[model samples]
Structure formats: structure tokens, C-alpha cells
Target chain A: MNKVLITGSEAAALGAKLAKIEVLGYYPITPAFPAMERLSKYIEDGELNCKFIRVESDHSALASVLGGSLAGARSYTVTNSQGLLLMTEVVYHAAGLRQPIVMGVANRALSAPHSRFPEHGDAVSQGATGWIQLFSENNQDVLDNTIQAFRVAEELRTPVMVNYEGYLQSHTLEEVFVPDQGKVDAFLPLKRMPALDVTNPRGVNTVAGPDVYTDYKYIQNAAMEQALELIPKVAADYNREFGANSCGLIEGYMMDDAEHAIVAMGSIVGTARLLVDELRKQGKKIGLVKVKTWRPFPAQAVNQILKNVKYVTVLDKNIVFGVGGALATDIKANLYGQGSMVINGAILGLGGGKCGVKEIKEAVDHTESSENKNRSEWIGL
Target chain B: MAVKNLPIVPSGDPGALVEAANYATWRIFRPVITESAKVNPIVTLYCPDGAITVDESGAEVNYKLCKGCGICAKESEGIQMVPEYTGPKGVF
Candidate 1:
């Protein structure tokens, strides 16, 4: 129950330990490597009773957890960038199979000219994979989101990816109050895997042809859709117990009556918050809308928040290459024909470059001053 | 399986590129390989105690200075170059 100065990776490790995760299947990748190391140390010290599977690749890391989960074990893993991509196939399958697994993704860029800093491309690429993607902006959220992630995943019978910016939050040390183990224990009881009886012998992950494949896919989509409704309710309950509420799908900071706002996800929200403070001091009616959850898209919530705003700029760390920024496209899809000056996309901080408060402030300033017709501008060079 | 005339980006260190590409490809293909076949080359690359590092930008790696000692590849089975092709020009 003591306060500890730890990085986001350590916070995730501690959260998993507190949740009493039974098995951890993982491969070491940048940013996420620290979490694996911490968990390995915990396993060595016997502080937590868990099976640590040292997999050769991220694909095995996720597959092992999926296998473990099917065997009725509370399982988890950590991955990033190409590692996340390596596990992309199972990532989709894990959710389709309704395995209540949780993973920590240190959001990094995908390949071509791969860079290992931090970006949302890795997690965003898996958007259609049907997992609940939660973006954490700080060390505390990293811990809280991870602990709740398991519970949310179980409730919805799907996997959850707790996405945070690599190096930005993952490696940066911050003071995070370790919640009381007893309190966490009360919220997340020892995860008892659904009773798998030999007498019942229900078939799991069976091969389905055209007839049932579509039906199965619908079921998976329906479960993900259910998460859009369930996440907020679970987050509310978690807040009541933990005294901390992560804005659920999207968090709005000083948005009421604001004229222009910046929309983003992951660690950039922190930088946006600081910029908002500075802009507020100058009496510029600008605010920020940080998407805490991205998979379900939170279309209704995003449109509702940006309904009154005249100009909205979406800052995306990862670009879709041919088509603008990923978040920008998503926002545009949600806000189609709203008559608001919607900027479609902006790409910045590719290959792990830092996006600081100055860059955020500049983006807002340029967007506000520009007279273009719904165009996107990349910030921080 | 031998990749025929794989299009590899010409960067400084081909080994690092191959390693990184192998790691990325492994991640992208992990779920399918692990579930269906355990004998996948990707899985073999990600063997226990293996590691991968991707330098997509080629900003940090100096291929001209590299001696191809294979220290990183040998250290961990998971390590590979970013592009999956070796040498400066990346031929065969």
C-alpha cells in the first residue's frame, strides 16, 4: 500500500501482480521489456506465484497466453511495435475466442523504417482486431487501467490492450501510489476460469467454414460493441473503489464552451493538458479531448464532445502512409457532414521522436490561424 | 523456406535490418504460426533468450562501420536484421 516511484512499465507489472495473474507469456520488446523484466524478478523472488513463459517471439507470447486462458488460467502478456504485429493474428483470434486476457502495448511505430521510440501506429493497426484498446496518458493511469483491464476483459469476455506511448510514459519515472493490495483484491478477486468440465467437454476455437464463420465474427463484433457500453460502467465502479476515474472512452479537459480543441490519444494527452493550461491563461477558448479508449471508436462520445466546437485539430503520432493519420480518419468518419471545420489528419513524431508542449501549442496556434478548408497539418516537424 | 529476391531497403547495416524485419515479420505472423504450426521459422527466430531491435530510420545504425560479427544474432535467437536481407546492396 506504499507509494512507489516507478515507470509505467513497473506500474503495469505491479498491477498484474496485485491482480494475481496466474500466468505471464511474453517476449522482450523495447519499452515493454522493462515490464517483462520486472515480472521475471517478481517470479524469481516468489513475491507472486505465477508461471513465466519465456517465449521466443511476441507471437508466442500472445499465443501462449491464449492457450493458457483456454485452459482456464488468468493470463497476460506485454508487447510493442513489430512485436505487437507479430502477435497480430492471435490478437484477433484471442478476442474472437472470447479469452479474457489483458496485454500491455508500449505503443511504437510499425515497420518499413522501424523506430523504437513511441507512437500509436502499433495499437491503432490492431483497431479492427476487435480488442478493447485503452490509452494511458500517465504512470498512474497505466497502473489503474491495467488492473481494470483484466476485470473489463473478463466482464466482456474479450482481450484488452492497455496502450501507452513507448519511452514517453513507459521509461519516464514518476511517483505512483500503489493502491492497497486488499482494495485491489476486493475489486479483482482471484480470477476463476470458467468451469471447463470433462463431462461437458465444450469445443473451443473450433474451425468454422463460411456458414458459421460470419456468425462467429458477428458474435465477436457484438461483444466488442458491448464493451462500448460496459467499459464506462466498469470504470465508474472502479473509480468508486479506487477513487480514480479514467475518462472511460474519451476524457474532455475544459471543453465546455471552448471554441477550438485538440483531440489526441496516449501520452500526448499530457502535453495537450499543459498546452491547454497555457492557452487558458491567454483567454484562448481552446481545450483537449483525449481518447482513453480507441477500439470501439467511441463515435457517439467523440461527436457529442466536438458538437459545439468550431475548429478541431487531431494530432496523430502515427501516419497511415498513403492515407493521412489514423485518428484523423476515425474522427472524420465520426464527424462527417457536421459542418464543423474538421482537419482530416496530421502526422508527427514518427519513429519515436518526442512531441512536447511547445509542439502541441504550435499545432493549436497554426490550426487556429490557418484559413484552409478542413486540411491536416503535421506538428513538430 | 527461402525468400526469392525479397525486396529489401538499402540501409547501412543489412544484418540489423534483417534482424529487425525478422522480428517484425514474426510479430505480424505470430498468431497464425503459433496456432497452426510450431515449426515456423519465425517462431525459431523468436526462440527463448532471443531479442530483436528495429532501426527503421537507419539513423542510429552505421552499416559501413559494421564488421558483421553476428554478436547480436548469436546472443539471442530472436535477433535479426530489419529488412531480412544482408550486405550493403542486399543481393540474394
Candidate 2:
């Protein structure tokens, strides 16, 4: 295998092509369009053979892919920001029907004021949709996770969303290892749900009345709970087969024996990794917890690592209006009964605002000096 | 085809819960698309119980198979929900 420098969009396209997806559907949106563009080129140049449908809207893109998956085709799609919001209806539909349609999300902030950059709000807002959510820290993680998503989603019979920061990973160029197509195909065989065939027709997305609607949703929830274990098992298999360490649900950097740690996801984790190294050189006990998987919430992993740490700061690029950062809320909830540990919630990088190293250092300083144990601070505001 | 005569709702439920039985006999007026309509009457995706089937001739709704959610009638332009039977003999 050769190492090549490519943007996150290109890596995503290459990953999908390698996975041997039989159908690709998407509507172009900023920061997310580049992946669709590359996939289209792959189809045209005969490098890949797949049914490429450029739908009129994001909703149709998701719906078409959902139908395609039900028809026994390995399907994939991409969307971002408002496009993701538009497709929210089918996002739930795909998950409810257990369609296993893999999607790439160029995670961007939603708009009333209209701004384009990197924010996790687009994907975080869909937390209740019952889709397995995976966040990437860089271009490499974006590609690896996208490839791994199909396997995870198919194994669990649930839809999976692979999210990377818009522009940060989508446009930024980084050196990535291009895995062999044979190995990817070996890892992910052509497996489809038993439905949409005329000869052996099976009903999907059936209407369950009040008597059985709760049971239907209960089964869906049961499948979602499987991801808490299955995601890591799939990652371990990928690591053994490809010899790549890019896939995981959560990654701790220099976390051992640290009193205070910074917790975050997406490309901000990379920045926090660098900051961790810088602080370690000056004999500071600060660490970083990179949350790669957000949907299952990684509750066990988070509680295990942070239980001993005295103070932890959760950095989120997404905020829930009056409620503070969404990730922070989950962390506080998970650590509720774990003892006298302090958790700080900080919201930064809204509407593509840069979460710089300076601001991160200042946040740590504020946490150290302030008497308030549980504080929510807005960085670089 | 022999029609299976069985209760749609279970027997051991509360009366209020069993009220859903009213929907069982409640017939959904299947929309008939005239030849002059120049449109397909098929429901593509939103059929709740896979009630709508489309073939070469056109779209057909199996009322017995339908959940009677009326999603097809509500969402599809060419379909409309009418009473199961307009005559007195169709009373539930």
C-alpha cells in the first residue's frame, strides 16, 4: 500500500469505493460536496462500478439510499449542516427500519444567521434519532471510520453516521494510508437484509399500532445498545487486518496519572493532543480524552477513565442554546454518582470559530483558578 | 380466496384499548384513479403496512392488508380516503 496526501473528502470517496458499495446517493452541500464529486468521478472513470444518483434534495438522497439498502444494495450517502437537518425525517426512518445505510457527515453548525465552517451541532442535534454516531479527529480517522462504519452498521442492523469537522478535515490535506481494496472487501462482504425481493417478499418499516409500537421501538433500542460493545470489536478486527490504529470508540492521550484532562471530539482532539504534549514538557498533569464514538455515549469508557481524575474539562463545538454543550451534558450525567470529581463544560468554535491553543490554555487556567467547580465557559467569545 | 374470520384485536384487553377494533371493520374507501387522470396512483415509500402494491397495470391498495393509517390517501395526490361502504349494510 502507498501513502498518499489527500483531502478528507477524497479519502472518504476512496474509502467508499474500496468498500464496494453498490449504490451511492447524495445531494451536494458545502464542505460535503467534495466527497460526492470524487465519488462521481470514480463512477465515470470506470475506477468504480456503482449506481450513482444525484438526487434533488437531501431528503431524497437519504430516502433513495434507504430504499436502495432495503433492495439488498450496499448503500452510502453524505450531507452537512442544513442539509442534514432537512434529511432528519428519513434519518429516523432509516434507523427505525434498520436499513444500515452508512452516511458521511461533514459536521457543520446549523444556521439562523448562516455561517459555514466546522461545528458538531449538525450531528449532535440528531442524537435522539437512534443512529450510531462516530466522530473523527483528522483526515485519516475520517476515512478509516467511514470504511469501518459499513461493517458496524451492517453487523448491528442499524444506520451509522461518520462525522468529521467541515473544512478542517473535509478540505485540509493530510497524508493517509490507502488500504487495499481486497482487504476491505474481505472485511466487509456483500451482506444485505432479507427484504425487497419479489419472489421472497418481506415487509419492512411496517406500521405498528399502539399495541405494538412500543415493542417495535424497544427492539430498535436493543440493537442500539449492541454498539457499545460491537464498535470496539470491529475496530480491533480492522486494526488486526490493516495494522492501522486509527479506529476506536475513545482514545486517551497522556491520561495516566493526570489530575485534570480535556475531553472533546472531532478535529479538536488533534489540537488537544498537541496541547497535552506541550503541557507535559512543563511538568503539568493535564491529559486529553478524545471521544471517537458519541452515539452510544461511551459511558463505560468515560466513567472508567475520568473517575480517578480530579477535574475534567469537556470542550464542545456544539451548544444546546440555554442548556450548554451537548457532550458536556452527557459527561455530567455519566459522572453524576462517581464521587467528588469536578467537570467543566466549555463551548467553543461555534459557526466555525477557531478553537486555538491559546484559548485552550486559557480555559485550563480559568479552571485552575476559578472557585466554581462546575462552570460552563465560552472560549474565544 | 377464503377469507379468514378472526378478531383483529386481542380478546383480553381493556374496553378502551379494544376500541381499536372499531378501526378493523372501518373500511377505507379505496381511491379509484380514472383513466383520464394521466397520473400514476402508486404509493412509492410511505405505505405503513406495505398495503399499496404497484404492477404493470397500475397501483392497487389491498384494504385488508392496509393498516388504515391513511398515509397513502393523505400524502398521495391521486388517492383519497372514502368510507368503506356508502350503503347501510357496511355498518361496523
Candidate 3:
């Protein structure tokens, strides 16, 4: 109804309620657990009415949601980190069958040390799963993206993952504008989805054989490529409907007249915006390119945005083992041989290690001074 | 939005050709309806792979897709399971 201070988890839950999801499935895990908790609270308090099932594991959570979707109901679930990894197989199944389910992924570090903080590793690892992946910078981004994902997923008959940092965006409170029920209802008009019929039962996941396997995947690829264009159109329509300009595939913050740009994703982009502002006040010609969409990599838009910049510093929250950061690899692959633009990856945070303005400044300093643009520097190690 | 609104056939819808394959090649033994067995055998529902069907006429195992799992013969009285390659001249 108005601007309210709420955590991203609560905001996402409210957004799902606003979108009138028919079923909610979840198996609790850290960071993402709170969002599920908030949604359950909504159900308990009668703020939202839906089928809420607490399954045994993340795998079942996804499967249960798939059942709901198959039954022709608007459905969603929440999980991140190890839970996301566990649901990998079902995630592919959801995409393969063209089930329009939306999921809120509070991104967290993949475990080994069993750390508890933010990292993009969890959601980034699912790049090939064919779900339209959208990253959020704040609570509002999380909420808007949750609702926007429904439209995208349902309209395209593809699943979507709205990702934000685990602790940074999940637990921390921010002032977010909560849309009213009437407007949200108008924004998301209910449409009957293709449903399972018991009277005339149909099989699910039958073999595609060699005759149609590649054809099915080709359809999937075409749908994904279509998303590359549909996403920005949805964002434009959302901005027109909601009067909010933050919904898009990428945010080119102060890129005009800039000589250098800092490319990053998720909550780090919010932090980088401040750093970019401070540096600009000191007469530095640096700008921030916050990547809002990852799965539909948005390479053309990114290429155009960074075309004139002579230096591009990349900040990747997740490392790709032997290779550089995932975002860095993506940006490098897109920009290779295009120009004399020097690109360096500032490996600032992995496993939720401490990364702040100071650490980011060190990376920026290295980018501004270093001659070798080929190596990824592990800063604040 | 063009592909988004299009009705794409989902993966698991049932049909006669649903999951069809040349599964009979994987069969160790074949299912047959015998004269002494029940008139209308209930072996139609036992095949997990949907390889066998039965009516008042008897059971017909679609060998093209039957894996010779012996599920029908084990579950119903009218069906019998026999080794596909019982001699040197057998296909197996």
C-alpha cells in the first residue's frame, strides 16, 4: 500500500501473494528459509490463501511445485545454495516441460566450510538450466522481480529464478514500495494455464527419441532466445504500469560520457554504485554497469553499453574454479577482439568473505594502474 | 512473447506413441497368451513400461516395445514368459 521497511524475504513473500500464487512449496535452508517462513506467516495470518507444503528436501519442494504447476495453478517455491544444487534435476525438468513456476533464490556460497553469507555461486551455477535468471540489487528489486518473473514465466511457459544475495538482500531490511492489491491484480490478470485432466489422463516426460529430442531442445533454445528480447519489453511495460524504472536486463548507471565502467551483478552493483559516485565526485571518469539478467546474458546490450569505455573492471562474486569469475568470463567472451578495451576481473568476494568499499577500492586502483588485463586478481585475500 | 504464448507439447503427455522405442530388443523372454489361461486376462495393467495389452480375445504383447520383463506372465494367469532365444537358431 505504501513504502514499508521490510527484508527482501518478506518483500518477496508479499510479492508472491500479490501475484496470487495458488500453491507454495518449500523445504527450509539458511538465508532462503526466512522467505519461506514469511510466506507461511502470510498463509497462517490469512493474508494469503494457498497450498503450503513443507517437504522433506529441496528436491521434493521443486517436485511438489511442479505438481502444482501441472495441475494448472500459479505456483512458486524458495531455495538457495545447497538446496538449489539439490533441486538441479527437477529444475531441468521444469524447464523441459515448460512449466511456468517462479522461484526466489537468496543466493549463498556453495558449502564446504559451511559458511553463512552471500555469494552468486548458487544461482550462477544454474545458467544452463534454461530458467530465465534475474538478479536483484535491493528489497524492491527482489519484490518487483518476483512479480515480474511470474509474467515472464507464465507468458513464456518457462520457469524463472529471481536471485539476490543471501544475507545481504535476504535478512537486511530496506524501504520498499509495496503495491496495492487492486493495481497488482490488474497488473497480473489471472489466466487459466493448461492443466492436467484425470478424465483423459496424459503421460508426462515420455521419451522423445532421436526423432524429436533435438527438436524439443531447439524449441527450448528458441524460447530462451526469445526471452532475451521479451525481458526488456516486460520491463518497459512494468515501468509504464508501475511507474518504476528499475526493472530491466541491465542498469547502466551514469555510463554516458564515462571512460571506464565497472561491471558486476547482484547486490554488489548497489555497493559499486556508491563507489562510482564517490569516485566521480573526485573527478574520476568511472561508471557502474549493474547486470540485472544473467541467463539471457544480454551480451548485445552489454556490448553497446561498454563499447566506448577504454577500461572495464569486472567484479564477480563466484569463481569458475580453474577459470576466472563467471561474470568475468562472460564479459570477456563477449568483448574479445572487439576493441583495445582492457578488462580485468576483481575477484573481490568468494565464500562470503569480507568485501566492502575499501576492498573494492583496492580492485579499482589495480584496474586503473595495472598493465596486464589478462589475469584475475584475488583481492582482499 | 511469440514463443511464450505458443502451446508447446509438454514432455510427459500420454499417447499410443508416448515413450515409444524399439524395446523388444532388450527382452530376455517374451510374453504369450496361453489357451488354458483366463478368457479376459488382467495382465494389461501390470506392465510398468506399457508393453502389454489384454482384452476378451486375449493378451497381445507389442514386441516392438516390450522389454520381455515377464511382468504380465508373473501377474496374470493367461500370460506365459518364455526365453526368446531357446536354441542356437534364436535371435538372442
Candidate 4:
């Protein structure tokens, strides 16, 4: 393992290089472009034998990647914010085709009072697209989870998007432990990618009737359901092989004796971890649950972990109108009818706003209060 | 109708035209590729849906795949776009 100080964007390229992606399809989008740029440089440098295509738009980016995957190649792409939204058209098509394409999403807020800030608005909005989503907490998480994503995506024959914050995670530099290429090879071997061949031709993605469409979705959903269990297995396997503890799914930090749980995803988990430690030092019974996988949500594990907790506060970086955030919605649904556990939703860090100690302190301030029951409101507004 | 026993992977029998949509019914003017329009690549090349294929025999239009775009007739004077005798008036 080599410890190199690099940004999350550079780490992403390193991960893709380790996976040895055959084709990279991408467009120029802020925060997300650097990763693809670095990967393209690798291809240009002849260090990696790969084909890099600079596409016109994120839609074409994903479409061309899908083409590469269809032709039996381990394909990948990356985008952020409006770019991800634009690629929305091809997202479902790739999933339906079961192409094992991995995309890196530098999560950014959607426009209309445009800001270059980070938020879950981009990745989380694509929740129902059937692409497995893994939220990277830091630079190392970006590197490791990206490698793990290829295995998960290929094993399940589904696509995965490794999401990190736009500027916060993408641009921030950290000392990342990049695993040896040979070790990564042992963990994830390039078994000739299962793709349609022209010689032994097969009609992939033929027009389907209503029932057939339903069947395709049923199978897709079944794989997603299976992913909840499969992700941990791969994650554990990767960790065992690498001797590194890259948390696969949702991880419980300081939750054993705590009555209050703060759930956070993406880069915000770093902040939440510190907050939990600080709160504990003050003799407060507080803990943190870092959600690593947003899609194929580990509801069963979450219910088990937070079952005894008195109250749960979901600090969402992305907001879902009228219903709070997507993370809050999923968590609340999982916790419903099981107990009288009060679930409070607090939205903060939209457009990449600084997640201040004061904001988080206020969010968790009412945790011990009797009046903190089910309060859903914006925090850093 | 229930679409049953389909392959889960995106694979289907090559060249197997199962329940392929027939464009003949929707065509107002069908391209009649006569023997005179022999090996006209222009007619086949201009077809947006690839309804026609050209060979030594002539340009043959696959009505099932053709959208009756009339591009073949426009591109080649030998191929005529005649109103189909089948639509609404009577069953062919």
C-alpha cells in the first residue's frame, strides 16, 4: 500500500485505474470533471490501456458508456448536479440492460440560484433509477468504495454510482492509502466482462411487452434487494483482503450505550463523527450512524442498531420537498410501527453550506428535550 | 398478453423477429420497389427505418419494418409511392 496525499478526484481515478476500467465516457462538469480528467490523463500517459472519450453532454456520456458496456467492456463515467440530471435519461436504460458500469458522482446542488456547493440533491434524486449508490465519506472511502463498486456492480450485473461531495470531498486533499494494483487484481479479477458479442450475436434490450417489462424490473429489484446482503460480503471481503476497515454499508460509531442516534451520509459523516465524540465527552449519551450506501438501504441493520435508541435525528444534506430528506424518509419508514422512537429530521448543507458546529449542535440540542418529538425543519436555513 | 419466459440478461435469439411491429398498417403511401429500380443504393440508404434493402434483383421493402416514409420513392424515380389499398377501406 502506498500512502499518497491526493484529492478525492485523484483518488477516484486511482480506484478506476486499479479496477482497470476499459472505457471511460465523460463530459466536462464542475467538481466532477477533475476525476475524469485525471483518468483521461492516465489513459493518455499510457500507464493504463483504456479508451477515453470526451462526450458532448452527460446524456451522451452515459449513452456511450452504455455502448461500451454492451460491447462487453467494464465501462465507467462521472458527472455532477445538472449533468447527473441530464444523464437521467440514460440511467434507467443502462440499469434495465444490466450493464455493470460504475459512475463517480461529485454530488452538487441543482441550480436556480446556481451555486457550486455540494449537496445530495444530485445523487439522492436518482434514488429510483435502480443504480446502486455508495456515498463516500472521505478520499480513502472514494478510492476503496470505487473498487468495491465494480465487484458489486458486476456480481449483480447492475450499475453503481460512487458519490462524494462536489467541492468538499472532490477538492479536499488527504493522505489516501492506495492499495497495490496486484492486490486489487486478486480481489477483483477482470473476468472477461459479460457483454454481448457481435460474432455470437444476441439481441440485447429487445422491445418488451408490459409483462416482460415488469419481469425485467422484478429481476432488477430482486438484485437490489440482494445487494443489501451482498454489499457487506464484498466490502468485508475487500477489507479482509486489503487489511483495511472500509465500512461497507451503514456503520455504527459510539452507538452501543447511546440513546440518541445521528444519521448522516457522504462527507457530512466526518463532521457527525466528531460531534458524537464531543457530545459523549460532555457526558451526553449520543452516537452516530454513517450511512455509506444510500441505495439498497440497509434498513434491517439500521432498525437493529437504532432499535433501543430513544430518539433519532437524520441530518440530511439533501432535502425532499414537503417530506424532509430522502434519508429521513427511509429511516422514518423503517422505524415506523416498531416503537414510539421519535424521528426528527433536520436539513442542512444545501448548496455546500458549511456544516457548522452550531448548526449540528442545534440539530442535536433538542435530542434530550421532551419537545423534540418528530420535528422536521431546515437547520442551516 | 403476458410476456413469459424471457431471458433475464439482455439477450435474445439473433435475427428472431418475434412479434415485430408491422409498419404497413400505419403507412399512407407504401414504396413499391419495382424491378426497374435495380440495385439502387440510394433508395436503401435514404430509408430512415431501413425498410428497404437493394440487391441485383431489385430494391425490396420489408413492409413490416417500413414506416412508409416515401424517401425511397423521392430518392429514386423508379420506385413509386402508391396509396396502400389496405388501410380503413378494406382488409388486404
Best DockQ among the predictions, by candidate number: 4
lDDT of 3: 0.84
TM-scores of the candidates in the order shown? 0.78, 0.84, 0.88, 0.94
Using Cα atoms, each model's DockQ against the true complex is 0.01, 0.08, 0.33, 0.50
True interface contacts retained by model 3 = 0.51
lDDT (10s digit) by residue, model 3, range A150-206: 988888889999998888989999999887789888878877675577897876766
Model 2 in CAPRI terms: which quality?
incorrect
Best by the TM-score measure: 4
Which regions of candidate 2 are displaced past 4 Å?
B1-92
Give candidate 2's whole-model lDDT: 0.82
As a whole number from 0 to 100, the lDDT of residue A309 in candidate 4 is 92
Model 2, range A196-233, lDDT digits (tens) per residue? 76774444554456766666677777778889899999
lDDT (10s digit) by residue, model 1, range B1-92: 32233111111222344354544443211211112221224433443433322333211223422334344444333334344344577353
| Arranged by lDDT, best first | 4, 3, 2, 1
**Deviation from native of the Cα of residue A203 in model 2, angstroms:** 3.9
Comparing only chain B with the true structure, the TM-scores of all models are: 0.22, 0.50, 0.60, 0.66
**Candidate 3 ranges beyond 4 A from true positions:** B1-7, B10-19, B29-92
What's the CA error at residue A80 for candidate 1, in Å? 0.6
